[model samples]
Target chain A: MKTLKIIKIGGNIIDNEAALSSFLEVFATINSPKILIHGGGKLATQLANQLGLEVKMIDGRRITDKATLDLITMVYAGKINKNIVAELQSKNCNAIGFSGADGNTIISKKRPVKPIDFGFVGDVKKVNIETLQVLLEHKVTPVFCALTHDKKGQLLNTNADTIASELAIGFAKYYQTELYYCFEKNGVLRDVSDENSVIREITTQSYQNLIDDKVIVDGMLPKLNNCVHAIEKNVYKVCIGKPEMLYDDKANFTTITK
Target chain B: MKTLKIIKIGGNIIDNEAALSSFLEVFATINSPKILIHGGGKLATQLANQLGLEVKMIDGRRITDKATLDLITMVYAGKINKNIVAELQSKNCNAIGFSGADGNTIISKKRPVKPIDFGFVGDVKKVNIETLQVLLEHKVTPVFCALTHDKKGQLLNTNADTIASELAIGFAKYYQTELYYCFEKNGVLRDVSDENSVIREITTQSYQNLIDDKVIVDGMLPKLNNCVHAIEKNVYKVCIGKPEMLYDDKANFTTITK
Candidate 1:
């Protein structure tokens, strides 16, 4: 199988222009057949505040009402995605930007309203592997925003972590896929505040032990869980680290294994 | 040569929800090998007002400074383009949205400051016909927002009329192309007030006569000029009228020819 890397970058890099530029420089040098997925940075909330839309949040996840969804569509899919594509193009990376709606590449169902109705939020249904594969074969790098769509004319707010995991799993059937979750941190840390205390490797047993010891909790918990899930689903490699790891041969980051 | 239809829609249909839905419903049924190019519409201006961003206009053209350019990116490429794509998908049309930056499909140079300093606007330099052909071959209808990118990381505000013309000219090399400019009016009118006074045919000679006679003046002149330009560039057909003409084989509209 051909090797393909699916890299996901969160808001930490996106919110800082210099960091994003530096990150893309590293991403551009990756050998070939790589995809970049980005999360909407703080701009959405800032724009929402400017537009006087109340952002309802239930436990860290945003309650994506119609107005909020529209705001995110404009911010994430429009502004950030295009900017990234243009920047990558400057670096000679042929980047193609996508919302789930584009080419119907990602179809998702709206989250069921039984417990908590996260307005226009969608859980991933499927990724159009053929379309993505064709683009990759043509040497086109896809830059995806954190948005999906129901096939019936609705754009849904989706988690970027989930999107990354889903895409890695989707591509696993055809490629030896490596999934990287790039954020601000160096890696999963033994101490959250001390960046130097990075845990170099994490296995499923180690992850369970970390959780039992309360070393990994909150937002990081779900993200770590996603990494484990991707690895189990046959994504060749899974790593969590800063963007520099893309180019660094001796990069110290948390690597997840079965 | 294979035949392809390229359609451009102005803001009137886009500004109204029901009208846009109606337009998409009609656009959806058009046979394969068609593209849709849409303008930003009044939503950008309305949102600008709400955000207190001053929309600077010079002789009816927006002076796209950085803020205004960002606003339009969110509105034109994000909201409107995605909405149209999703709606077309609902109607079973596999629509893909594009910014010039995406796939480097359309590359432009920032408009020269000598003329009036139309800030971030761009003039079309080249259209990547290969990328577009690939998408079209895959049965994807590309819906373009009126924005292009300079290869060095800048998105420029481009005119939809020019973008439509450029695409028609580009596609003419591989396909017998028909370009349609869809706006609010029935067609080019003998009198601006009367919608029923639609001119049935307009050849280059007759179009010049209409101008000398002062029947076609103001905004309609440049549009007709674009039509004439497209027709002369060997686009098989060029028509200007309301959106309904896409599906109306017997639609009475002004047809442009050499």
Candidate 2:
């Protein structure tokens, strides 16, 4: 069977140029077909500061008002997206950077708020797998940023983790691909602060225990959610681990299976 | 009439950090309501070369085969677009970078080639002025790069000049905005080699003469065509000049009038 992978890198990984270059080198060596999705929170926050635009957050989710939405759109879809593609090319990796907005690759609907408006934040409603598969067939790596378009043709900021999950599910259904979530941490740790104590594997039952103990907070919550979503959608495997530990046989990580 | 302006910067201008900063300083001082569109040919070509991908050109238009199209989309839509927005913000300019793909701000039709397929090149067919206007109303400067989407949901590479022209026409019709085409050259010169011998103004008759004499060639041809199109579309004024001469009383440039 042909191997397909969805690799996700977050804001911490993408914000550092040197780290991005190092990640690209490792990514180029992967023999299987892959798609990359990235986040751009650092860049967006910096831009917001410069523009005197307030960065509002509601429960860790960015309140994407008009100004914040524009800022994120520019940073995620424009800067971080292209920088990754350029880095991949520097390593002789054939990579193409894109976003949810491209060719309607990811269509979504605006999350209508009851009291406060989200301006342009979208919940992923659909994914166009055929377009992505065509590029992958030509050995081109599809690098995507988390920016989607609503049904009314408005650009909306979406979470990178969510976007990657949706894409993994879509690819899993379309081409039976595996999903890998790579980040700075060493998967889900038994002790929240201990990086070396990586959990070897996780099931639906154990996942709830970790959450009930309040160990998974902030960024890790969404990542776990994505993993569950991918597994439920019948992906071959959903691996969560440190970037370098991906290839290690004994690397501490969590593998989610249905 | 509200003096709205659209300024287009060549891809060459933002080749490096120093050049980008220099341009941003000048860009920050402009008081008029404006929109920015930029090109990223050099960066795209460099990335393509590193990946050992063949860059094809036909009739002076890029043949965006799978590899080339992906590289162009990533570089133009991502890196160049965000960098400009960041630079502008650093200078206290509220700028928002985007692409034709965003919110379907610019919709296009794939350039149908029968003999030799240009996989992802698009000819723009429509512009979503309402989306842009909404951003503008919120005091956000919309910075666009040259990339669009086809109806079939494919990301297509469109010409930067074409994007600027279409945007100028749209803004003019929708908001009565002025259009300025700024480049390295002082203006449309009478002698191609002599930069100082700028043609102050050119009527349709003189423009035809220049075209007949083979004076306009390469990159300038499309720009000239765009200028003529904007003028014909009833834009308030279409000026072709150096960035420095944009607001000069005796600016050495060419103005196209209907």
**Among all candidates shown, the one with the greatest DockQ:** 1
- For A1-258, candidate 1 gives per-residue lDDT tens digits of 899999999998899999999999989988869999999889999999999999898977789898998999999988999899999998999998888888788899999997988899999998887777878888989889998889999999999998999899999989999999999899999999999899999998899999999989988988998899888899899999987788888887999998
How far out, in Å, is residue A232 in model 2?
A: 1.0
Model 1 pairs in collision: none
Q: Comparing to the true complex, what docking class would candidate 2 get?
A: incorrect
Residue A28's lDDT in candidate 2: 75
Query: TM-score (chain B) for model 1?
Result: 0.96
Q: What is the interface RMSD of candidate 1, in Å?
A: 0.8
Minimum summed lDDT over a 10-residue window in model 2 chain B is located at B95-104
Instruction: State the lDDT at B204 in candidate 1.
Output: 90
lDDT of 1: 0.90
DockQ of each: 0.84, 0.08
Badly placed stretches (over 4 Å) of model 2 are B1-258
> What local lDDT does model 1 show for residue B30?
81
**What TM-score is obtained for chain B in each of the predicted models?**
0.96, 0.93
* Model 1: residues with Cα > 4 Å off, grouped in runs: none
